[model samples]
Target: MTNHQETIKQLIEQIGILSRKQEAFKYEIFELKNKLDQLQSSIDASDNVEKATLDQTDYVVKSEPIASGHREWIDSNVHDEATIKQPSFQHHKNQNSKVTHNTPQKSKKLSPFRKSNLEKFIGENLLNKMGILILVIGIGIGAKYSIENELISPLTRIVLGYLSAIGLLGFGIKLKKKYESYSAVLVSGAIVILYFITFFAYSFYELVPQTVAFAMMVLFTVFTIVASLNYNRQIIAHLGLVGAYAVPFLLSNDSGRVEVLFSYIAIINIGILIIAFKKYWKPLYYSAFGLTWLIYLSWFVMDYSNDSHFMLALSFLLLFYLTFYLTFLAYKLVKKEGFAATDIVMLLMNSFIFYGLGYAILNDNAIGEDYLGLFTLGNAVIHFIVAAIIYKKQLSDKKLFYLATALVLAFISIAIPVQLDGNWVTLLWTAQAALLFWLGTSKKISIYEKLSYPLIALAFISLIHDWSYNYDSYYHLEDNLITPLLNTSFLTSILFTTAIGFIVFLQRKGDFISSLKEGSTWLKIVSYAVPILFVFSLYYSFRLEIEAYWNQLFSLSELENKSISDYVVTVNDYSLRDFKIVWVINYTLLFLGVIGYLNYKKIKNIVLENSILVLTIISVVVFLTQGLYALSELRDAYIEPSIYYNRGSFYLIIRYISFAFLGFSILSLYRYIKKDDIHKGFKIAYDIILHITIVWVVSSELIHWLDLAGARDSYKLGLSILWGCLFFPFNRFRYFKE
Candidate 1:
């Protein structure tokens, strides 16, 4: 009995253990099945590739056979469930990897947040703005239809327009608490409507007086401004400001009420200036500025007259100028805000517009034309004082200070041309340029240096103008009574060239050039351009001076003997040509000499180097043309003179001076070519030309002397003799070898 009881207890305990193991396996199988379902759903939800791969995958779970005796003891339901859920785990893992690795292409899906935001923009912002625009247009069209068809009386039409505007404004205000952006669009539409209504009331219907309509529109502008501020909407403010400015023009009846119109614009400006100072709204400030000027400019263009409206126009200009001037600088002066590029640009535009308008008005009136310079100078002084104050107070960034300084210089530069004409302008510009350059180097202010460039350019340009003017005035030699080098124009040219040369000298002598970075554009300009300009200016002035001196002599001769023959006139003309040839050749030789010196000093310059090569080609042309003509002149003057030709020692000197300079130029050019790294072919060609030129000059001179000695018929004999003398020595010494 005891043995049988113990056996029963052991069987019961084993059964309990088996039951607990089966329950735990059941929970594990349930969790695995849940994971498989999630994985399958994700694969379906993925892009096309994964879906196609998943569609081909098999999802069967295989069951493993347990020990035969244990399988019989386990519950059939639990066994079936485990078999159904357990085998899919390994297969799905392998298949998942295959699907991932073999997936073809990915399609980017938009995130939920961005997609919703885009929908909101289309629905709220875009649709609302477009709807408001359409509504405004519809109102305008409806009013036009009613006016044309007599659908409503004019007074009633105006009343209904005001009512509609009031309704929209009130609705916008009510919606401001929840729908601020939408409210702004509606409010802007209402402001436009109000502007049209008020304008139509006064101009079209004639139901309201100008003063009353103006007062109503002013009220509307104030209301829009206050509502925009309360709503904190910039779009609303921009529309309100634009409509307010447009009202005056829309209500125009050609009455030309200058005082009223200006007073209204002035009031609007003052209010806008206040708004700009308060809100720091740059767009508002810019809109007001642009619109105000546009209206004022339109009025000035159409209706202004110096006789009737000078004081009124001037007073209003001053008002507007001071208004915007203070508005532009308010942040810096009052709040000590940092200056930005927009501030600088707006301030400059304001200054320029005021000056431009003021200048036009003054010149048109003719009473204050001379004061234009002082007016410009006054602007400079004011700007300079402003810059000084800013610098003294340290109210803003240094850029503003620099801007003010630049404006001062700009105004001063402009004042020069406005006040003076002819060489006075050029002389003053050169002086200013020199002063600026000196200040630049001494004070180490690069703005001064850069500013000097344009001043010098203007000086050079004005000097050219002076030359043209002088040319036109003194076209005839008899009319040229001024001294050669003592006149205003020539002296100014000299001073201009001298100033530029001095600037270049200082740049080289001081640390300025070395301070610049290598290959800088300014460095290249200073190194090459400045010196070239100086040389050119000097050459041009001297060439003209020499020509003038010759002309002076001819003119005096003409005055003494006014009844001379045309032959003598021709002789005098050729004499002038002779002097010109001498001058050109001598100057060219000097230029070549300077180039050679620079090359010898190893001062490498691309321009000067290329100039030498170019000069070689140009010299060939000048020699063939001018040189041969001069030789012809020498023959004509000495050997075969015209009947009225006046023979003198001057003819001999002119004839020989060119050949001497040509000889020196050849030597200078030869040295340059030898020192330079030129092609051997070029050198050989140069040598050939050199020998030809030498033969030409020597043979020509020989023929001229033979002609002078009454041997004109034996020119071939003389040429043969010269050729034999020249080439015999060249062949013997082998001097022509490359």
Candidate 2:
């Protein structure tokens, strides 16, 4: 009897272990099914390539999960984003539209990795450590002396600096040749010592102008000459060694008053020649000038602008800058064989970035108020010299452009106040709006490339400060809302700019909506939304008044007198209630629509797209409801909460909904784009959303399970994000996987 009982107990234990194994297997199978669903979705997305447009899958840069960076281009105001489908010219013809759609190619191709010698050395991580060590030790001595007596002779200073640099460079060569190239970093210390000496000398002693210019020429010439002497890597290493010393010498002339800044120019041209002749010097020597030009002008502007009061001196300097930049650019423009539409855009953008830099630098009044006057004259003079180059395109355009842009701005900044009799800040946005439309129609440029952010920024600023604040500050529903309505009209007009930009680009390409088979769903949607967001105020004119009144009352004067205040208070209360009802109504309707759509799907596998979309709508509902609740507190009972109207949240309803929707949408669309591959799209989109949700919860701190300071409690709700990930694999087998 005892033996039989023991046998039964052992058998039971074995069965229990097997049962546990079975359950574990089931769990893994569920997870794997979810993964498979996601994989299927990716496959579907690939099948739906409209043209190789955003199919630049490599550019998606998977460095880290995006909380925000450049990728947050899907926001409402992202006018420059690739939101429209530019079809082929053939499609334009097929559409037979009466409009002359002449959209230029979309984006410029980034230059390939053309590594110069400097890049090679950096990439190889050559002799870095040794270079750093030598540099540091040299610095210690200089600092010691600087602290001790604060005095060092020019000749002694030069000698010590050179010795430190040579020592570091020599050690770098030895270590790098025998062991690892990274050893050269030791020379970083020596380079530091080199900079210290040159900096102190330049800062304190105003070396005679002739001597300084002569020294700069000599330094530039010597480094290039030295690099030319040897093709050996060590010799070239020595080339970079002195180039570091010569780097600071470039800045010695920044009084900006150098009417003949030609001395440095002459020296750099000579250095460039030496580099061209000397194979080894080409990279290292070129690097010195490259480093100087990239940073020197921008950095030295403050110093020179502060010192130079002479307008002609500044004018001459700008002349030289524009002259050289154009000469180099002109050579490339002429010589670079075939000119594609893309190449033209690149050339234009490069010129624009440089030209517009003057706008930012104009903020410097240290150069005196007449700097603009000087810039205008000097800029026009250069354009005349280069008119032949731009003549084919009626390129008499440079001066024409500069003068027109500046003068129009003058009308905005100066003439407007006088014209309006100083009572109102005239709406410059209308002019911007008008210009945007005309430019889009006239200029044969692509939307993604041609649309400039500055105009959009101006419109948004007006939306925030001018329209919103004007209503709240002065006019009210109680007083009059015509002022606010007018502002909204202007605001809507300006926001229509992106669409106009799109239309213009489409007209330019002549193939606007031809790629329907491959265009992005989101882009199509935003195309519709931009117009709506632009005219949002028009849709709810009364609501805008409610908003303006509530904001002004809450912020400025709460209930003031009895009768008037009571009426204001009453209007505000009604508005806040509407805000909450709007949230519930919008979200509930959205939820029902999604469910109904999902139920109508012929198969469960196809439901990923709808499911993700519904979740997004729901998330927005939660986010905005909370927002309306917060805003309701701003004013007394009379003021309504402006949930989506005005007020800011880093994790606001729109942002949360947009991201959640986008992530899921992309995943879902990708998985189920193909009928047979439906399950895959849903799975991938679902999994990623889960991943996204988890990340949002943790990073955003949306949940309040843990105490948070400020609005950080937004993350407390983030815990719900796991729904995205969990649902994908758990219900995998049910997805359409044909």
Which candidate has the top score in lDDT? Answer: 1
TM-score of 2: 0.36
| Residue lDDT tens for model 2, 531-611 | 434334332334544455445444332233346546533222344443444434344434434433453463252233455
Q: Give the clashing residue pairs of candidate 1, or none.
A: none
Question: 365-482 in candidate 1: lDDT tens per residue?
Answer: 7788979998899889989998998888865666678788989989999999898788888988899999988887778777777788888888889989998788445536555667
Off by over 4 Å in 2: 1-262, 270-295, 298-313, 337-361, 366-444, 447-461, 476-511, 514-517, 520-525, 531-537, 540-542, 545-738
